[model samples]
Each structure stands twice: as C-alpha cells, then as structure tokens.
Target chain A: MKKVTQILSLMMAIFFLVSSMGNAQSKNKVRKMEYNSKYNYEVATIAVGVDGTKLVKVWGYGPKPEEAIRHAKELAIACAIFRGFPPASNGAAAKTPPIVTDDSVIEKYAEFFDNFFAPGGKYLQYVNLSTDAPPTGEDRVKVNKKTYKVGVVLSIAFDELRKDLEKEGIARRLDAGF
Target chain B: MKTLVNFIFIIALALNSFGQAKKPTIMVVPSDRLCISKGFSQTFDNQGTQETLPDYKKALQNDGDLRLVISKMSGMMADRGFPLKDLEQELKNLAQEAAESNMMTSSSSGSAISESPIDILKRTAKADIIMDLDFEIKRQGPNKYIVFTLNGLDAYTSKNVASASGAGQPSSAATPEILLEEAVLSYMDEFNGRLMTHFQDMFTNGREVKVMIKTFANAGISLEDDYDISGNTDMLSMHIEDWMANNTQGGRFNLSDGTANFMRFEQVRIATEIERNGKMRAQDTRMFVNELSKYLRTNCQIESKVYLRGLGEAWLIVGEK
Candidate 1:
C-alpha cells in the first residue's frame, strides 16, 4: 500500500511538470502580432486612361511572413483577372429583359463560362502590369499565435485586360473609345 | 404534340424568370423633421414641457394629400417589382412583440422590466431601403404650389443612397391632394431616375460595408513593418491591402482613413449573413470581416475576435493572441 501511494505521488508530480511546461510555452510564444483591418485595399490611383489603372490589392495569411506575401501577390493577380471579367448582370434583370433568348444555350455554356472566368483561362494572355514598379507591401499583421497577414498591391492594366477579353470572344467590344 | 411544345415553352420561360433574383424592398415614411418644420405635426404639453411630433396617424386618416402620393408611388414601385413595406403593419408587429416579451419577462417582484432598443424597429421592418418623403405647400398670389423631396437611405447603414427635390407649377386646384399630385407628377421621372441610379450602383458595387482595423497598443508591432513569420519577410500592411482588393466585388472599396494604429474602410463589399427576427438572412458585411478572420487563422495562425454592430459595420481586433 505504501509503495502504491509513493508511485501515484511520483506520477502526479511528472504530470504537473509537463502541464506547466505546456503552459509556459504558450505564454512565451513569439507571435507575429499583425494588425486587423476591416477594409480590403488601399487607394493609390495613377490614372493612365479614362477608367484609370485598376490597383488590385490582396492580403495573404501564412504562418510566415514570406508565405503571406506570396499568397497576397497571387490574390492580387486573381483579383485583377476577376475584376476584368465581372458578372454580366448587375441585378438589373427587372429593368432589362434577359439577353439569353434560349435559356438552354446559357445553361449549356454556363459551366464553360464559370471555368473561363476563373483565375487563369487558356485564352487569357497575362501582361505584367507590375512592370511599372515592383509590388509594394503595406502592412504586417500578426494573427493568433502562429499566423501573419501581409498586404501587397499590384497595378493591373484594365485597358489591356478588357482588350484581351474582347479578343478572346469572352466579351463584346464597344465602339465608343475610352 | 403542339400542346406539349407549348407546355415546354412555358416551362422554359418560367424557369428563366425564376433564375432572376427578387427586387429590393423599400419602406416609405413621412420625414418627422420635415413635417415639424413645415407645421404638419401636432404640438402638446408633456410634463409641462411643449413637445411637437409628426401627426402621421391623423395625417393618414384625415389628410388625403400625402396618402394619394404614397398610393401612387407604391403602385409605381410595385409595377417595377419593388415591394413596399407597410408602416402600419410593421408598427403593429412591434407592439405585439413588445407586449409578448413584457408578459414573458415579468418579474416575480415586478421590479425588473426590459426595454427594447430603437434598432429593433429597423430589423422588424426588414426593408433594404427606407424612402423618406417630405413636402411643403406654398401660396403665391391666387395660386398654390407644392414642392416635394424624396430621400432614399440604406436601412442598415442609415446612409443616403439617393435624394431629389422638385417643385410644381402654381395651380388653382381647390384641394391639396390634386395640387400635390400634379407637382409630384411633373418630376416623378427625375426622382425615380435618381433612385434607380443609386440602386444600380449598389447592385454593381455591392452594398456598402464599414471596416475598421484596430491594433493593440502592447502588440509591439507597427502597421508598416516587415513581418518574419514562418521564415517569410513581407510588409504585413501590403498583404492586408491586397486581400481587401481581391475580395471586394469589382475591386470597389475605399480606404477612407488609415493610420499606424487604426484603419477605416468604407464601401467594402463583403457578402454577409444577417440575423433578423430570429431568422438568418443572406446579406453581406459580416462575411468580409469573417473572411479576413479566417485568412488570418489559416495563414498566420492568428486568432481574431469579431464584434458586429448592426448589419453593415464590423470591428476586428488584432494581436490579442
């Protein structure tokens, strides 16, 4: 009975020590301490045309600073592509009648359009708009204990993006010049 | 075979119509401030203090001038697929809810009573926009003229989306109703045009959402710094800015205010879920903030606490981890 009690006490001490070590590690963790923002992008408009150059901004979250930066850069490119090919309808269906005379045709090509409008399409040729200058980093925000948020800004040539879409037959070009 | 073909054609048209989303709901209310200023309200002594308020009940019952205008406007909106929310029905529901809640939460000692906040009225109405109507009649020589103004405001944000004011030619009409209608009819197209323009902008840009970024003073991190988490060196601010640009519809967002410790983003289009009257409706605003929180959690291992105010505003605190 005495031996059993001594062994139980020894086990309790080891368990307590391990638990305290875990607590200490959490308490002493070196976190990224990133800023939490409500807005998506910062404003830096350098007008080159009537519509102005689209400044595609994106945020990247990663366990490391580099990962977040890389992710943000990728997001900026994706945003530019998506912005270039926004939804055809802006909820004006009530005022304007449906353009698709045959619903079945739209239904058939719906999947193709969905895939076509994604980040990278086979028809799209990307011209590096970031050629004007290298990407500018904005903030380093530390999220929980492990993650960090980094912001990157890229100047996407909206004119070029529009021209590419029209050339690819994805969009119809208007006669009115910008 | 002809009948079957007709049936299939009808089905196709029905399906196509169903694919379109419902139009936004609008509620029209007489502006209390305008009514008071124009001497259209009632004044009474409350606790020996004189108080004046819009006599909408009396106006609706006895005055046909505004009533005719509302009826005509509502008819036009309904024809355009925009549904009108009844102010009387909304008030009735509010009163019923208040009575039921009061009965349920009655204390044993009868000392504690719960008071409902003013915001509950907005939620119960469930209107996407509120159209405030104001009008004034002026007498010039032997003729009387009416001038009217309509202000369209977003229900959640209380931001004016559209506004227009116009006056009608002086008429010898005996009643205010006929004269007011004539005045409103002259500029109805212009007023409707402004409203449609605002709605189209909102539909294209996405509903406006206010985003605020706050940093803890003790976080030991500045907004403009190279963060080295996971062996990556990048300016954290730029990454956040990029995320905002990517998520918003048409990349439409405005960074109205930014500092090392605080950042305010206006017109951020984030799809959000709003809980109203015990039912969660798919709206947008909270979703944007949630997306930011999720990105931080997944990428930076940073945990964020989100505090949502109403439907269009969100506050996020960082560096708490």
Candidate 2:
C-alpha cells in the first residue's frame, strides 16, 4: 500500500507539469493567415513608386525570375505611355474603348508607342531602382508553388515624352501647372 | 393604398432631408498685412511661440475700420441666410470670461484643461469656414475703387477651399465703408456660390481628415506584434482598422497606406456636431482626435499623444504617453 500511494503521487505531479507547460505555450501562441495548399498557382506582387516627376516604376511577373524581370521593364514602359496619354474622360468604372484608325491618311502607330516604351527606346532612359523584398509579417500570404515578383523604376524624361506625345496628338502641350 | 403611398413618400422625403447639411457658419477677418495696416492685429505668444495674430479684441473696439468691414460682411451673409460668427465680439467675451475665471482659480492649481486663443475661438464660435479679406482702396483720378481679394478657408484645416479676386468699378461713394460695401456686394453672389459649393461637397462626400500613426523606435514593440494568442493579426493594426471603421460616419474612411510601424488614414469623415458659441454655430470636427486617443488608451493598453494641426489632420504617437 505504501508503494501504490507513492506511485499515485508521482502520476499527479507529472499530469500537472504537462498541463502547465501546455498552458504557457498557448499563452504566447498567435494567429496567422491561412493559405490554400491545393492551388499550385504562382502569386504575383506589384508595387508602384510614385515620387520622381519623370521616373515611373513598373512590375511584372512570369514563370521564371529573369522573364519576370524582363516583363517588368515592358510594364514600366507601358505605364509611362499610359501616364502620358491618360484618358481624361474615363472614370474609375469606365470601360476601355476600342482603338480604331483610318489606316490610309493617318497611321495608327500603336507599335511606335510601344517601341518608345521598350528598353533603350529614344524617348525614354531606364534607371533601375532597388528591388523590393517580399513583405514580412503575420499577414504575409504563402503560396504553394514558385512565384515571381519583379520590378524596375524607369527614369524617362517627361518633357521629352510630353513633347513627343503632343507631336503624336496623344497629349496636348498646354501647361498643366498654373 | 393612397394613405400608405403618402406615408412612404413622407418617409422618403424625411430621409432625403436628413442627409442634407445645414448652411455653415462663417467669420470674416482681414488679411495679415491688411489687419496690421488697419490696426486689427496684435503681437502675442501662442503657447511658447511668439507670433502675431489678428486681435479681434482691439479690432472690435468701437469705430474701427476692420469692425465696419466685418459688420457689413456679416449683414450681407445674414441676408443670404448663412450664419455669421462675429470674431471680434466672440474674442471680447472670451477675454472677459478668462479674466473672471482666473480671479477665482488659484495659481497653485492651474486648470488642467487649458485652451489656446485660437482653440477658444473655434470652440466658442464653431465656425466651419473663415473668409479672409484682402482689400485696398485704389484712388483713381476722380473716384475711389475697391480692389479686393476673398479667400474662403476651412477653419480647421486652414485649407483655402475657394478664392475670388477682382477690382470693383470705381464708385463715388462718400466713405470707404460704402465704397468697400459696394465692391464686395458686386462680387458677393459669385463668392457665396463658391463657398456654398465647397460646403455642399463636404456635406455630401464628408469632410477630409488626415491621420498618421507612428510607434516609438525603442519601445521593444511594433504595430505588427501579435498581442492575442487566439488571433493571427497584429494588435495595434487590427484595433486601428476597427476604430477607423466604427468612428467614421458610414464607415467613410480610407486606409491609404499601412506598414508594420506606420499607418496613414485619409478621407475620414467624423460625424459633425452643432456646437453653440454665444448664438452662432456650425458642424465641428473636434471629437475625432479625442475619441481616437481614448480608444487607443483603453482598448490597446497603449497610451498615445495626439498632435492636431489646424482642424483636419491629427498625428498620434503610440509610445509618447
């Protein structure tokens, strides 16, 4: 009977110790975002830099890292073109209008606009800014497959772009600053 | 069926009217140079900063040019049904009250709640808009003409919402008062229209409030720290989101930017209240920072110091308590 009593006391002590340890761990445990594991899709991230007057930032994503970066430069050029020749009348919810051309008397030159935005284009010069690291914190989402987020900041002389855009009739030369 | 339709129509009308805001109160003051030239300004220290502000007290003293201009402007506004706040009279009252209160309260225990002169003016008058006048009487060959500039500013933000400037046709009026009045009245319609449009936008879209939240560098704490074991979100961040949603009318707030240690909220619309200063009143934005600070202290267990600039922007530091 003495041995049995000693065994019971030891069991009780072990149970309490386990329970307290669990409780302490639980006290410090925090919640984190849950992402789907079933979807094997790549997540693309883009962040815009809006500070420099003539420098515009762009980001693109692809299957490979280099391809993603190359795509980002193209995106940067596209961004510059859009910024220069922005549709003034379009509201946030407005639908994109179809581009049309007469083709005989006037050339559409859509490809010309793209060529200017392309890397080493005459109207624009590219200056690469620092690449952004992945966002950190509890809110950061995890993806199942390999993902790519590539970006670049292009330094395009806006005055040149403005003048070219005006010549192309894409933008007016009226002074925006009063 | 007819009675039911009538009841529904009445309800709709009431709801429409409820969303509409009443006319805002306005106060007119001469521009700094004009005030100084006309002897409406005085030199004084605001808190620890020594600067010159318009002394409505001296300006309101009997038979001053600023007083005459303000009175005429007030009459014009009153005729248009817009409420007018007399800055001079209000300042005088405030001075009298401060003197009386100071005599009764001992110096050892200064009032825990102290307001700056501008704050007292804002609190008392509850004027939403301040109209600043910069006028000069130009002496043409045979007549004296008024060359005036009018700026409608948000009392809280100090943002110039509307402005108008033009030279009035020369009038052979006997006094500068009549000449100025005639000049102002000539453009008053357009000026008042601009003022009304700005106030209407504020009423419909809600007033803009800019808020910046920052944490101390050495506090061993960040906005991303998880305070609750059962939740995954950061403690301060979640609380800020909830506060912005709950405090703004109709959840009318935009979280413009957010990072681990900083957050910027723009276009926040706090519910405006009609406060009385003497008999004049307007919708006021005073409750925003007070309520936000109180929430941070109570719920997050984090004390914050709120720094308000003008009326519309508030800066809060979490570790500065």
Candidate 3:
C-alpha cells in the first residue's frame, strides 16, 4: 500500500503539481544598502535629422526606480517602433502600432538578456551606465534597426539644480551630410 | 598491534576511497525553440516583426540582474557534466512548475534571489538533491552614477544585528528594480548555458532527467525595501522542484532571444528519473553518487554530500543552474 501510494502520489504530482513546496526560513530578509553608481549622467537628448539637426527628445519621468526602469523601457520601445526615435516635429512620423499595452513594456524587456549592441556598436552607442564617463555627443551605439551616433549622459537631479538640460538639431544623416 | 594497525588502515582506506565532493552535472543550454536576450523576449509576430518588450515595467521588474546573475549562478553549476537533456528538460519542467504553483505568470517575470545555507553534509537524497547558492553585491562608491564592485559576502548575525554578508552598505541612488535585476542577472548566464548542456547530455544518453531550480530573492520595488536581505531559500527550492517533475513549464517566457529567460524555483526540487534497460543495486548506485560527489567537491565548491537512488538501472539527478 505504501509503495502504491507513493506511485499514485508521484503520478498525481507529475500530472498536476507545477511548483515545488518550499519551506524557507520564516523571517523575511530585507537589507537596505546603497552604493555609488558607476554610470554617468542620466538626462539624454537625441537629435532628429531633416530640419537642420533638431533635437527629438524622449521624455522619461518617474517617482521610483521601478517607474524609471519602466519609463526607460517604454522609451526604448517607442524609439524602436518609431522611425526616428522621439520622432520630432521636423522628421517624418512613420506610423507603426505600439507592440504592447502602455502598461506592459517592462515585462517585455525582462524576457531576454544580451548586450550585443554594446561592444559591437560602430555607429552610435549610447550606453548610459551609472559611471563617470557617460556616453556623450556623436558617440556610437547600435539600435535595433541600425547603429547611429548619439549623445548620452547620466546625472542625478537635486533640488534647485542647475539646468544641465540640452537640445539638438538633426536630419537623416543617412541622406544628408553633417 | 598488527590487527589494530590493519583496522585503522582499512578505515583510512574507506575514507580515502570515496574521494572528494561531486561536481553537479549542470548546464544552462539554449532552448531549441527560444532565445532570451538582454531582458527582452523576441519572437516573430505573424507579420514577421519581432515582438519585443512592450511593457517596460514588466521588462524592468523581470530584468533582475541578467548578466551578473548568469555569471555568478554559473558557479553553482560548475560541474559541467550534467546531461544536456537533463538541464534543458529540467529548466523547462521548472517553468511549467511555475504555472502549476500560480506564480506571477505575467508576460515577463523575474524571480527573487533567495539563498539557502543548508548544512553542507546534511540529509541529501540520491533520487533528488538540493543545493543553495548565496551571493551579495558590493558598491565601490555612492550616487546613481557610482561604481559597483561585487564580491562574495558572508552574512553575520549578532543579538541585535541578525547578520551581514560581505560588504553590505547603503547607497544614495538605490533602485530596487535595478538592484534586483542586476543581482539576478549577474549569475544566471552560466545557468542558461548549462541548462542547455545538461539537457543535451540527458537526451543524448537516451535518458529522461529533470533539473529544478528554486529561486530566492526580494519582491519589493522600493529602494527602501530590503529585498536582498530577506530569506526564502528552502521554500523556493522545494517549490521549484515539485513544479519540474510535473509537465507544465510554458509560462509567459519568450525564449526567442535566448539570454533573458532563466530558471526559477518555488519550493520544490527538480526530480528526473531515467528508465533504462539495465538494473543496478542500491549500494552500487550510492557508490556512483559518492564518486560523483567526490569529484565535484574537488572541481567545484558546490556541495559536500550526495545522494543516489535507483530507478531501474539509472539514477534521478539534481544540480545547480
């Protein structure tokens, strides 16, 4: 009977059980630690080419880091879907339907892992790591569609802060020369 | 005197014959159907356009340290000998298990990093083995743009201060989402690759095996919440394992890119039994497990004990992801 029960139970488990039972420590572990970020400034301004190097800005604002990450992912997807990232008034607005709901962009990004564009970037690699040397103007990075020159920066906003904000002017460098 | 010496020699020989710790036959192989890349799940839509991360919050929430977790998690699966079939099958099983357990089957989900410090040589079974890999992050400076230096930290506990691991410190620009992603991804790559390898090996030998991974980590998204400092190791291990032996691993994970998706454990262990043609004695199976454990201890700092059970002429296996 014991062996039969074991077999039946194992079979039932095999048939239906999805998650294994976990008996972890009862106490919840919550550690609060902070470290200096290595990536450079945060604010980034991208130039939209066509109407004489006009800057097409992708605005990202959030109260928490989750919100910030969520915002950043949305902006990345928007950049990918739209022909010119942050399609400025000057450049063309190539119509492409948003891939996911406004609420589910981060879930999409977390589905995979890779840094193919980082080292292999030849055009404009806009890596905004929390480091000292933030990606700067005309730097090279690889976008989903193609690579381009970009101006990347990282910074933390403080109260009554100075205006480190920026604007850019761009046209399809592919068609028109700088 | 001669008899006494002989007895001592026999005991010493017995101890020495078993040898060292056994390395896990673990691998994180790529799924033949999907590839996870850069916290993004890429799959061709009916229109042939790549369906990428549309929900950035889901992406960020699940983007728990892809690179760092892959790198560090590889250490847990350093044995490099698990059948590839076992790795792949087990990872898939664990995923199905996730669904069974009613986890956040949201389109994209990143699990927590919970470490279980089991007794090195505790009660381990041969049919199913359990292990816990613990890691901590260290920062070199402060601010959102500060440098982060990682190291293996040890947790300490006092009367008031329960414990600390490595160099636990606070940062000014602490983003729970970012930190969780970084910590989870840093050591998970090894797991992804190994899963592929382990499964490949299992299938190659015409044996069916399973690998279950139990994940432990924090869930809060606030910098103020100490998600990293929490504990859920044992429960996750057990839960994840239970999920795998059952067939149900397809969650919302898109594996087209092959880098972002990883193994998650709820509260169970991964159990895969191979039905082979031959048969073996229980003692012999134990001996093989003993040998494997001995080999692992020397090659990788995984575990100190091993268990081996008989299934026909084969063995059910478990290892790190």
Candidate 3 chain B worst ten-residue window by lDDT:
B153-162
Tell me each candidate's i-RMS in Å. 16.9, 21.7, 22.9
Q: Could you give the candidate ranking by TM-score, starting with the highest?
A: 1, 2, 3
DockQ for every prediction shown: 0.01, 0.01, 0.01
For model 3, what is the error of residue B209's alpha carbon versus the real structure, in angstroms, after optimal superposition?
A: 11
Please write out the lDDT profile of model 1 over residues B1-321, one tens digit for every residue.
999999999987755544332245688888897667656688899999999988665566665666777877776565434657876677678778767766764446665355557445534545667789888888889877677778888775678877766565565655677666554443343355456566555555566778887777777656666655567667666656777998887777888888777778887775333344554445645566877878867776666667666466777766664
Per-residue lDDT of A42 in model 2:
24
Chain A only, candidate 1, TM-score: 0.39
- Candidate 3 has a TM-score of 0.20
Pairs that collide, model 2: A31-B231, A31-B232, B156-B311
- The residue ranges of model 3 lying beyond 4 angstroms of the native Cα positions read A1-136, A139-178, B1-131, B139-171, B175-178, B205-321
Task: Assess the local accuracy of residue B139 in candidate 3 as a C-alpha lDDT between 0 and 100.
Answer: 50
lDDT of each: 0.58, 0.57, 0.29
- Which segments of model 1 are wrong by more than 4 Å? A1-178, B1-23, B38-64, B105-126, B155-160, B203-205, B214-239, B259-262, B269-283, B305-321
Among all windows of 10 consecutive residues in model 1 chain B, the one with the lowest summed lDDT is B15-24
Q: Give the true-contact fraction for every prediction, in order.
A: 0.00, 0.00, 0.00
Model 1 misses residue B112 by how many Å?
A: 12
